[model samples]
Target: MLFEDPVFASRMLSLLTLSIHAIFATLGVGLPLMIIIAHWLGIKKNDEHYLLMARRWARGFVVLVAVGVVTGTAIALQLALLWPNFMEMAGHVIALPLFMEVFAFFFEAIFLGIYLYTWNRFDDQRKHLLLLIPVAIGATMSAFFITTVNGFMNAPTGFQIIGGQMTGVSPIEAMFNPATPTKAAHVISTAFMTSAFVLAALAAYRLLKGAQHVYYKKALHLMMVVGLIFAIATAVIGDFAGKYLAKHQPEKLAAAEWHFETMEGAPLVLFGILDDEQNVRFGLEIPYALSILAHNHPQAEVIGLNEFPQEWHPPLFIHYLFDLMVIIGVWLVLFSFVYWWGMRRKWTIVTSRWFRRLIVASGPLAMLAIQAGWWMTEFGRQPWILRGVMTVEEAATQSPYVGHLFFFFLALYLILVIGVVVVLRNINQRFPLEQDLAHEGGERPWIT
Candidate 1:
């Protein structure tokens, strides 16, 4: 038996469940925003292909968003039960944000339901276009509100703990936590980026297969443009976030870089083995990279993980996660830029087999990057539910039956995973071949 500490095991399980839950979250929060935007454009251009794609995407969004809501509700309840101390402290500190999140959720649900049902209700183009605005607005608000909760967790503002009881909580401080703006921008932009790439991948895959459809080509091109622009923009914002963390959370930056010395001109580790006792990543190095990244000066002193106590340091596993995210992010930017350039040059992308294969691969690559980035954030914040305020051990539920809780969450998520796959497959089947459409009798000329 591993004989892990109960608190540690609980934290691990919490991370696992939350991570799985959030995969649906990005899709839920992001897909709807893009769908509404595409739908609006479709209406404006009076383009049937755009309208068809939007309707198709909306259906998938409806199913996945429903699952996301359910899973998110579970996570919320689990948070309170799994860490009562954390709930007590954070509930008081960030109550306003949590309350506001409820409103955002309600807004999203209402607008999404309307969009799903009233596809043909509004004959007037302008009024129908107006419907998409609420959907986009709701999605954006939902994403921002959720990030407010996470930002509070990271910066832990809005309240003080006196003798273990929260006191003098301030809603404004919680909403405007130090991490609020940065984390919100980072998360929302990345969501947009992910949605774009995923859409592009699907469209490109069909186009490359010689589907002989105009719908797929136009959709892929637009999606490619959106994905490329946002992916690059997200990277720029992430760089700013990296600098902000270096200034405010040096330990996290150090752990991410696997730096072992607090010194000038620290070389970043491209790949190395961590010698925990010696407190260094041995073998390989990239000269002066850490110094440049941290301080914009090659000789500027950059702190290292070794400066912190062993118990306090984030695990090496999270360092690898952070690295994977960065590496994949770079690849996405490069690939997206090239793909967009090809589109500008008159859609050479569809004709190139190799490029088409790469496009199909881009969806999974971007998804992997998003997952790794989140792991870096949550896992990198180790031992602290609220950074510097409360340790994970202090906040963990005292019950030893956490194993049972873990299995329950595990089983629930497993069902959700199966449901998502089945639903997506059914949605995919909705977009049929022209031959299939012909076979269905020309009565229903519309693809739907």
Candidate 2:
């Protein structure tokens, strides 16, 4: 068990790195894309307010992206140090995407810098707007490459073991591996979904406080539209992604569905306690829904956790994560509908005290959705390091010092969190958007 102790430590280290990485991932993908889209619209319509909004958001995004890059680099380095066997075996297959991710990072930084400093240096509006294309593309490509690597992990491909050694690794095959496409699409959509909800929540807060300036209203409307669009898209794609997982990773689907055995026309446990020893759900159930969802048949049989030995069972913690994600997603969809309907009738919901309460709650809900979504992805794989080839324990750092990495990252993230709060406070204090625009700069471009 002493040797196995390091395995747990290694997992905790990776989780720390992953959790930090998730923050960056959310900001890196979500903030930049939103700003870029806003910037594009700004340039197209000659709307100075839109451009100003874009610049402010981009400034915040730049600061966050800097931290994101630092945390991401740390994660990549730790991956090699902690999972040497996994790296040595699968690194070659993922080399191309990893290399592309680096390029994406550099390219995004380059354009972002130029755009930050080149407003006066470049007189042509069209040329200036062109700079954003690369910035947007680079940010998106960075996320896409990382998602591809993650996807490959879920459904590995592009290599073989010959005489106990992985050989003939193919990058192309790995990029198009079994789970890569669907997983990438799912993650990409979730990023947008979480971002929209977060932005909407912020805008809703402002709207509720009677900050009815033109700029704030515009921002709120934009956020609402974005939230509605991404919410609907996420629902459709999530369904597709779920069906894909059901076909390929049935055990994971079973765990998420909370099914305890092979059963006919399984009742879906919407909210329940899994009695693993007794192999039954001990709470609320929706009759025959699981069978219909998983197999499109009312009486279709679904396998469950009891079919696998206790040692091989996926962690119950992970099953809870899956449930949390699904529940939050459904909540988002419902809230989005309410918001959209209220907006059509002149934002009656935002002015109401009850809606303001809900708006405040949505901030944490959005964050929980992001964390839960990732938890499901990483934890649902369960024992697999490569989904059919290796176990999590087998792929972990064999070294005793792995726990140090976890503590190091915990301290680092605490510092980063403090820094983020300080920066946000300073921005709000110095340039309070709720106040009159004349007090700031008389509609001139002011970067926060």
Candidate 3:
């Protein structure tokens, strides 16, 4: 029956598209900042390697941006087609932030083009670095606007819904809704951490293959340092996000924590398989830990799914995914500390083969954590598309052909994923080694 529902089909398709799009989206938000940093460092140290690394990173960023544009356009179209009713009602409020996002995208694109093109043309390093400031700001602003819109969906404000229609719309207020701060901060911090780990993983892979180039070493060091800082920051922000959810979306938080009965001093479920009876069949729980984490007191009251109607409960599986995300976050935080400790002690860990392997492994793990975190967020907001405003069944298109469309888009995404991998691999292979650069008589290599 679920599979027969067009609403379910539409939701699945949207989730698939978002998951695929998020990889590039995070990178788009983050890689530009890293490039800017690399460029700035290059200028400060007169290091051609940092500059070259920045240029190469820019090429990858461009490819991802192109793909992001396609996926982003598809998402926009899906919103209109699949959720026309929701769009018609709240389009005005949503459009405000999205329109701002478009400007941000254009600003990023313009500065990115200028920065990439003027690499060889600009003899002045300061001017070249200055161009990247807008690129970083624009990219971050783009994410901020988009996340603000999503935040509005989670915690809508600035409008009254009377007689099934939105009225008294104040787009500015909606843009700065209660949920925006925590949501935007969490997303932006994860973007930077994800991008840093990706670059660090690449450097580790090269080092593992016996590449002793200073470029790889420096890249690894820089990316890991950035990654560690953001990774730690994300953990702290994640706590604030949890507190926000506890206060604003207690039911969703309950499902995520697997609190089957409302109680004080709730234990934090670590791993669990929930049954149809609303019971966690098997799991580990840290007694009183969730209450302390969520409310800073062991005896603090924590709501449960049973407090709401059965139909209103978010999917229980979100608990597992949420736990997985937290586990990965903890691992990354610990790894970052170890890496930092080694760096302070003259970088002794770089010589360890096991550490290099772990670094190589962290890339996919970071990606997994990012995806899992999103899964917890989106899926935890189940039964409602706009949280207390409209249900997914009300928002989804009535057309029965959505299932076919889902399959089509799934296939399309598969092709796009393969194409991206192939293109990026070829680009990586084409990058000139440090030895090649040394023999080139100081000629700046062109990325194109």
Per-residue error for 98 in candidate 2, Å, reads: 1.2
Worst window of 10 by summed lDDT in candidate 3: 434-443
- The digit string of per-residue lDDT tens for model 2 on 279-333 reads 5455567898778777778798888777877655666666677667778777877
Whole-model lDDT per candidate: 0.76, 0.75, 0.88
Clashes of 2: 0
Tens digits of per-residue lDDT for model 1 on 1-448?
2214568657767777777767777877678767766777877897766766776787778777788888778778878877888887777666677777778878878876776667556667567657667776777787798888887777777777789787888888888888888788988888888888888888878877777687777777788778878888888888777776777777888877877679998887755666737455454577987888787888989987778887768766777777777777788888878877766676765458788778788887878888888888877787688889888878888777777777777898898889889978976776564543353323333224
Question: What TM-score, computed on C-alpha atoms, does each candidate reach?
Answer: 0.91, 0.91, 0.96
> Lowest-scoring 10 consecutive residues by lDDT in candidate 2?
439-448
Error of 2 at 183 (Å): 1.1
* Model 3 ranges with Cα > 4 A deviation: 1-4, 275-282, 346-350, 439-441
Best by TM-score: 3
Q: Quick one: ranking by lDDT, best first?
A: 3, 1, 2
Clashes of each: 0, 0, 0
lDDT of 3 at 54: 84
- Candidate numbers sorted by TM-score from highest down: 3, 1, 2
lDDT by residue (tens digit), candidate 3, 33-105: 8998888888789887887778778888999998998898899999999898889888989998999999999
Which pairs clash in model 2? none
Clash number for candidate 1? 0
lDDT of 2 at 223: 64
Give the poorly placed runs of model 1, Cα more than 4 Å off: 1-5, 208-210, 276-284, 346-350, 430-448
